[model samples]
Target chain A: MKATREAYGETLVELGREHPEIVVLDADLSSSTMTSKFAKEFPERFFNFGIAEANMMGAAAGLARSGKVPFASTFAVFASGRAYDQVRQSIAYPGFNVKIAASHGGLTVGPDGASHQALEDVALMRVIPGMTVIVPADAEETRQVVRWAAAHDGPVYIRLGRSPVPDVFPQGAKIQPGKASVVKDAKGRGFGEMRPEGERDGLDADVAILANGIMVSKCLEAWEILTAEGIKSVVVDVAFVKPLDEKTLIELAERCGAFVTAEEHSVIGGLGGAVTEFLSENRPCPVVRVGVRDRFGQSGTPEELLVEYGLTPGHVAEAARKAVRLKWAV
Target chain B: MCREVRKNVLIMIGTAGSGHPGGSLSCVEIISTLYFGVMRVKPEDPNWPDRDRFVLSKGHAAPTLYAVLAEKGFFSKDLLPTLRKFGSPLQGHPDAKKTPGVEVSTGSLGQGLSMAVGMALAGKLDRKTYRVWALLGDGECQEGQVWEAAMAASHYKLDNLAAFIDFNGLQIDGRVEEIMNPSPLADKWRAFGWRVLEVDGHDVEALLEAASYASESLGAPTAIIARTVKGKGVSFMEGQREWHGKAPKGEELSRALQEVAKS
Candidate 1:
């Protein structure tokens, strides 16, 4: 089953019902951000700022000050770029319990073009001190991350994609902030038996594919295709981008000969950059990054943009092949 | 109370040697009138849940807020010399955590008004009659977020919120008109669905009257554009852009203190 990131809205509505302190704030695009359902149910607790992203951030900060847990909604582009200063000073600097639940993150926003697509939101937000950045892989993961964001203290930015992607993880999967989830162990035979002791550690695998958000499904599909060709691979989902799972990442990088990172954002300063910076010092590995290549996107269907920008399973498979060849050549 | 507030502002700015004296002085009467005559507040219980919220939105004018809080007995007036000193609670800006009676930390332009709206909205949700008042800078109106807040206040129908725009007409650069014009300000607020009121900022009686009217008006938020002279009551600094940010030096401090003493 596939799930759209919009499914997080259902979880948010449930969270709001369970917690009276939780408040929802949206720009005019509540429907787009999937927060309108929550708004409809709890109009008193929900605020529609109407196309004013900056004011929403400041207001959310104030709501946090008034002892309300505020979940502010907008597209990733506007949340991170349009009101970066407000988020920095009012929310992040104050260490407020404000959830910046952003939808249409990355190039997946597609047809809305580059202006609306926020390829650098993760990078920009992750750099802020005390900010927790979560990139949920699918709708189920989005729901879980949204719940964690509400429960967690301080500021959090949950990145959600606009398109629906496969549910790689089981339903009700527990997600911990700053912890990466290992969805697939490519070396495991028949998806049940554990890998031999030597390969179990991940070093024997030809390459590891690390991905977040919608790209996780793509990496999984690539893993299946690569396994048939006898190329061993390990698939790890970097659900939490900031305060990244350094322990799991270091272990994976040490065991895997090479790494290929995939995300729906720009190749520069995102999941790929985070992984590269971590591995360079802890465990050096030949890394092949697959994402938007430092260029603005144009109007097109999500599928068209994914293929045009080489973000499909086939692209991940090719990148993995390249990473393996590079590792062996070196 | 007015005399004490003016004296504190003069002393604080004189000691800091780097505070905004003009806007601070311009807002004295409004602060004095609110703290002394208008607001229903407890001097001892600064954070009494039912106490009305006051936000110094034009936070560069911290000296004025500190003076009022001190006069209201939040702290001793003798602490005025610590203004802008190392490790003092009296910073160049009003930090809610550091200062008593400061509802929100605001030094950044165009943000305090939005926070005040949130406070008012919270009051509505909590079913509290406590009102929220915000002081804004006329020069700060150039920020688009101020109008964004203005629109939201109207949309939310925050009748509990009252915003005062210190129409001092001077910023750090020069006259607001020569820098970035915010003229026809009252109509702009009206267009954004606020009940706009014009008043002489330095006239305590008029300001108190307008505050009372805003408190009584229902169905929409009120914006009182208090027209004031920059650096009011200080003859040398009055209406001068140079005095907007600079504090008085030793000789100048003595001279300004003498003028303030007469007032």
Candidate 2:
């Protein structure tokens, strides 16, 4: 039950040993961002740039241009907002080999509230052309994505969490960029989940739950609740939000036809938003987006925030039911 | 050397029909001094591993950099006419990927200094002797990122980093003092623990001396406050804020070209 940030730090140290050019920079949030582990391991490669996120971002661009893979870490809010111009102009525009591994993303940030939580980071990063945005579902996925980020030679933003999340994938589950991994598939369920007789759209899945980050665990819980009710559902872990596992999503859209897109982010421009955007373009269908609905997160426990933000198993199940019930005119 | 580059900058900007001739012409001497005399670069190999990096922080002055890099034989002289045009390597701003000699992409203000700090830090990590230079505008200093970079550069003790502030009193709105004062610039740099050097920007020799001093100074970065004139070398545009962004037109182009030709 390690936090994604802890896995990030450990993976960075591993990458540092393997790739010497990989440098770490932080804006005084090394402890929180978990780059302090890398700092302790490789003092020369780790740069603690105080609390200047903008400068840290700019310096990261320079380092990347100078034949170094730089991972600049800070809280997700500051990284995506305060230094947005720096990230856009210096890193994204130029297509530098810089990785911004931001921590404390989404409602899971808890007591820090909306001011620190970055519900819009995925949207912010995904909008930039050629910028790869990754939201790992768990610690193992975070490690895999971090490894992938180091090897992939372009600007990438990997959003991480402060709180420890449940393990979704196995020990050695390899995460490919822009590919959705189906952790749970509906196989042995009864025919109760199938669409009504003539109303059948010939889709494979009656309902699909697409989620990322801390919400993936809750999605699995919702799948269990649906399974007990004789409803067959597939839970897809969409960690990559930018390139968006487009092929997988399109296949899922063709098969499931109905989706409940859940995430610990703003419903406006997050995992839910990305799914809606993609499906509307290629394959139009009914989508129920389950996330923070146009509201700021307040100080609370991680569990309370998840429930308050409507990101629990109950919310996911409710959205799935709504999506399954919606009648889209073919 | 600077006058020669300034003449080319005038020609290029005037030919492009629209560009920042004032700010571009202001730091002609500083960029010229760095590329022609001070900076250790290879036009033959723009990506030489050990080459000193120069970032044009105030991207409005890209014409000067484009002109200087062309003069240095980094690319063909014909590319200068294509500045700001469609699909041109000589973009409106310096794009490191498109341009051969440009180290990093910079057009947005306050970002170049931070990139320089990163380069300096990289050099230190690699134990390399190459230094990083970033040229900034007086008005560009008002951006909070510049100070953020300033503090980081000093905090890291990056002696391999040198930043030049083009103290060309004018900005687009009006005089820099009128728009948003960034005065007492030298003292501000000193307080940030930089080795401050004030020099007459147009004097190529003084600029060279400042660069050399900055390269040698240890334990901290150096900030050379260069006293320059906006739209310098041209009589009508000099000290005028309107020229901060406007291009020279018809008779103005011919007159500006003629004025730039002279000492």
Q: In candidate 2, residue B212 scores what lDDT?
A: 91
Task: Report, for all candidates in order, the number of backbone clashes.
Answer: 2, 0
In terms of lDDT, model 2 sits at: 0.88
In candidate 2, residue A283 scores what lDDT?
A: 88
Of the candidates shown, which would achieve the greatest DockQ relative to the real structure?
2
Q: Model 1, residue A272: what's the lDDT?
A: 94
Put down candidate 2 lDDT per residue, A1-330, tens digits, no spaces: 889999999999999999999999998999999999999999989988888899999999999988899999999999999899999999999999999999999988888777988888888888898999899988889999999899898999999999998898778765565788776777633222433445433336678889999889898899888888777688888988888888878878778889999888889888888889989989889999998888888899999888878889999998988888883444
Evaluate all candidate structures by whole-model CA lDDT and list the values in order. Answer: 0.86, 0.88
lDDT of 1 by residue, B41-115 (tens): 987888787888888889899999999888788988888889999999888898776777877777888888888
The RMSD (Cα, Å) of candidate 2 is: 3.6
